[model samples]
Target: MTIADKGPRTRPFEANWLARIGWLLLALYVVYAGAQLGFSWQRFSDGLGQGGKFIARMFPPNFTRWELLMSGIVESLQIAVLSTVVGIVISLPVGLLAARNLMPAWVTWPARGFIALCRSFHPIIVAILFVKAVGFGALAGILALIIASIGFISKLFAEAIEEISLKQVEAVRATGAGFTHILIMGVQPQVLPRFIGFAAYQLDSNLRNSTMVGIVGGGGIGATLFTAYQRFDYDFVLAMLIVIVAMIMVAEIVTGWARKVFQ
Candidate 1:
């Protein structure tokens, strides 16, 4: 067992010439991008001064439109909740069918395709399409978020199901259980917690998206905020932003509590 007989000890990783060249190229690109974008310390300093004046004008936010704000908030909540419920209900079956171990290829392929289609676009893009098809309002927002939620949760849920312990599933099948019975007894128990987690996450996401969809005339606080911006009502815009932040914080807290309790 001499040093030379240790079978050529592996050398520690060191930066190679190629790695050094890559770093140099990255630095050069950053400098070029900064120049192309007109980035300058003097311009940044001037912009800070302009920002200070803008902030001064936005002080003492106007709550005179509290009624309008409340209405918008309620509509957003409804859209988020409705979308979550519908998405969760639909995703359950789709996810189950997409799990390759549980379903035949014919069933899984179509289910996967549907999930892919649902998730192909951003929620805002989907909302725009729905707004065009269904006319503008909460309905369009709800449909758009529902599609987004289904695409997200269903894909993750199917993967979770696929990764579950097949031994338990096989045991259930060995007891002369039907396919549905095996799913209920074995598969559902293993994946239920993960499913709940995905649902909670989707709810949180939908709440955030509900506010955004309104910018495209899908009824919510975003529409009001956009209008305020157009009218140069920076004070009202700031107020709306504060309310949105508070709402999102509350939602996060509630969802955390639900996850803990359920777990």
Candidate 2:
């Protein structure tokens, strides 16, 4: 071997001084920002005292308004299920169209733009708009959640489609299959499980969001909880909070089960 053939020796690992300095600067900025926000020990101490009293008032939550609670819960469930279905149906086509690897620029651009518009506003803001436009109710909540679902699931579906093996799609095409047939045989099989998983997640998210949308007059358990809060019905508020927490936990369990089943 010629001496000139060997490259210079180098360390196997080296520290990045720039990253370390950046991290130090970030830490310093956080401290500076906190100081600027007027963080003080005395205010924290006072907050703790208030928190204790608030907890004391929340014990032994009232559940006497079972009928009202049940109605709200049922409405929320309906919103979640219906919105998930509508979103899944719509997202499938849009997502397929948006996949850059599968579609031309003309197709992907419009599909992507639509998804971006849907996601531009938070669901709460969308709910507020629908509430004002539709004059408030479960309809508004459902519409808002449907938009949210479409915005979210469509993006995932597009990316999933993009990541699929083009070789499989080409193989289907080799048999002189039409576009629809190629998509069904090559793409749908790859992404169906993922689509199901995303749908389950969206349903769970919709259930939680449905409760909050009602606070803005969109209709659900949130409306009842908001009313209880306005009336200073602390015990009932506590009961509602507990129920919401339980509902969310149950949804998490169900979604986990669904993902496993589909996987």
Candidate 3:
């Protein structure tokens, strides 16, 4: 048969010239952004020299302020734990109500709105607001982190509930179980592990954020770190950094252990 007679035979896709041009335009935009951000070789070389000087000044980190550091760490721990507990307690009902399949529109809409409001701002900004509202210190930080945790976990929890096996739920209902009973027996079992995972993750994040909220006078290690920065005490700053890193690592390990135990 002649090639022309074969007509439109299927063939491998060839790269369109338009697509190639689009990629070329994207590359040009990246280069433009780099230039706008002052990402030049000369600027990088200068930054390295300044960084080396900063590093030299940070050597032999002073730990003479051990008492202050310990106090701040303890306060941060309290804030984190308090926020996690409060957030988890509040999230359970809100999450259940936000699950569309499980709740009427009147309930779901308000629950979703509450979640959105909680998530509307960064934790630091929320902490600042709380500090203004309720006065500063660990209380403000705890309240802020609690709001953030509720926003995060509740939304995820609702999604987890929505994705659960409907067949199991149907079977429970068929056994003449009421809505509450079905939820307790069929729905809770399916999503409990994931809910635990989310709670642990929120606790870990709250620990890290509790430290940062102190920078804004909400109370924690961050306040001391900010004071050290104001005094140009880079050695103390380095010491604080080391301790913060250790705390985060320990939190991560503890969270992992909890997840494993619960699983």
Candidate 4:
């Protein structure tokens, strides 16, 4: 074996064979999926005209139905606040129970399982179920979003707790502080900021979900939007959509302020 005969030991721009093969497979799958989904350049081009007409119809949004809009908006706000408060309250204990470091295996297992169950269905699906069970209304929407908030916030809260520095907790324990005292004095402080941030984020998410839950008879602006859509009153639909957007924007602002306050 002469050095020259070894072909400089390696080639420049060496390829990752596994990566290349993976990319090739992904490209093939994307093409297959696109074809199956009826995605085509011509179809997209043709849709643009319809989209323009729809946008035109949406302009000069009819807000003559101000009372209807206000009522739905108020209901959505109520649902968002009630769900968020309930979810935050429930999540605090559930998150503490789910913390692997702070809790026993028996405790964490059930807590984690409950959170998973809450997350198993989308809010809309849950709302539908609630409607089916309760015969439709804002109460159904409130319950659906509370479950969603618990699932999302509890998971995040547990993860945040796990990520917290344990040195403070250990120091408190060394002082013979009881478990409850340690959790109160040590653990809560470390996690409170993150907890608040999570709560605020969940509240914002619930606001958006509250709007949609109404479509499934959960009650809110979504019902109005759906009705307008069914009636082909796109101007009214536009009005509903604008209100929803404004509501969401206000929530975002509030949560943003809250997140900053906590952090």
Candidate 5:
């Protein structure tokens, strides 16, 4: 064909004017917002210097109150474990009920609404409320984590169930199987692996939250850390932070192993 007869060559890349304009607007808004909020590089630099000095005071951590530290850590662990276990058990049925493909609208809507309510607030806010209701201690922390776990695990579980192969479910039904039998033979196989992974993740999250819940009087190391901070015991605060980090790292390892074994 003649060169002139060929169609126009298209560029490999095209500039999207709409996206470019959107990004430009976003940058402009950020600058305006920063100005309004008094955000300046000079202020940030000064804050960093102060933060460094505060961090310096945390060294040479005090371990003289080892008994108190140990008790708090143990309580946090108990809260995490109990909440994770209870949440997983409760999540199974709630998740099944919330699955749109499995349950009717009447059932699914209520279950979904309950899940949404559980997720509507932060765990710390929930912990505070539970502390008031239950009158504090580890019980409040456990209840708070349980609510958080239910919200997260149930939603994911429902989504997983919804994504399962309907063909397997139909096949099981064709065999004159009941709902329980079909769930066991068809649905469980597809979603169990994912559910286990979600449960492990919730456990890890609960472990971290258990520490924070104590700050609100839910009972954990967070209460101890808060007390240390109030008393200007930076050294003790550093010790608690170190212990919390170590506990989280160990929990992560255990959860990873559990996921691998389950999968």
Candidate 6:
């Protein structure tokens, strides 16, 4: 019953030397990048002073042009709702086709490729292109947001479908169900709740992007905000920011409630 009688003790924890080295390298690179980008305490302090002055100018938000503000807000809301509806409808088939578990390789590959193409560009870049193509209006904004929604929701929906329980799917197939019927009874039930959540989240995103697309002449509050900036109307800018924040908060609440109801 001496020490020699005991089996070799296992170490409670072991250091991962490779991971430690990798993290050290990452930290060093961050410092090097910061220096290259001219990030310094002195520069940051000077920025704070300029930012303070800018904030001072934005005091007493001007809602004097309520008509313009109301119009821009309405347009942004329209863009968000329309884009969400169109995008979700399109994502249904594209996402189902892209799910490797559900569709053949021929179908999934092309569907995934299309999704990747949609996601390749930022929404702002897409909006700018649409603006150029369509010549400055809500149509450009709606199209751009729709593309963004398709990219996001479809990818997530495909992933959700892939993760569903195959047991239910097999059971449906055993019942002599065809592909369409199997999807309706087996696949749809499993993924519909998640799909609803994704749709709600995409609506929130579209709302934010709708405001921004107008900066590129896609037509929304962003156009008005950009005009105010150009005219040094900081008060109006503040007012617009307040409204945008309020809109986002409301959307968050609505989406959260929808998620609960569906779940």
**lDDT to native, each model:** 0.93, 0.91, 0.94, 0.92, 0.94, 0.95
Deviating ranges (above 4 Å) for candidate 6 = 1-20
lDDT of 5: 0.94
| Residue 83 alpha-carbon offset, candidate 3, angstroms | 0.4
Off by over 4 Å in 4: 1-13
| Least well predicted 10-residue stretch by lDDT in candidate 5 | 3-12
Candidate 3 wrong stretches, greater than 4 Å: 1-19, 35-41
Which is the winner by TM-score between candidate 4 and candidate 5? 5
The candidate maximizing lDDT is 6
Candidate achieving higher TM-score, 1 or 4: 4
Give one digit per residue, the lDDT tens place, for model 5 in 186-218: 999999889989999999999999999988999
Residue 216 in candidate 4, Cα distance off native in Å: 0.3
**Candidate 2 vs 4: which has more TM-score:** 4
| Per-residue lDDT over 1-52 for candidate 2, one digit per residue giving the tens place of the 0 to 100 score | 8866688866678889999999999999989998999998899999999998
lDDT of 6 by residue, 216-244 (tens): 99988999999999999999999999999
The TM-score, computed over Cα atoms with residue i paired to residue i, of candidate 4 is 0.91
TM-scores of the candidates are 0.90, 0.90, 0.90, 0.91, 0.93, 0.91
Off by over 4 Å in 2: 1-17
Candidate 6, after superposition: displacement of residue 4 in Å? Answer: 12
Kindly provide the TM-score of model 1 when superposed on the true structure, using C-alpha atoms.
0.90
Which regions of candidate 1 fall more than 4 Å away from where they truly are? 1-13, 36-43
Worst 10 residues of 6 by lDDT: 3-12
Worst 10 residues of 3 by lDDT: 6-15
Candidate 2 global Cα RMSD: 3.8
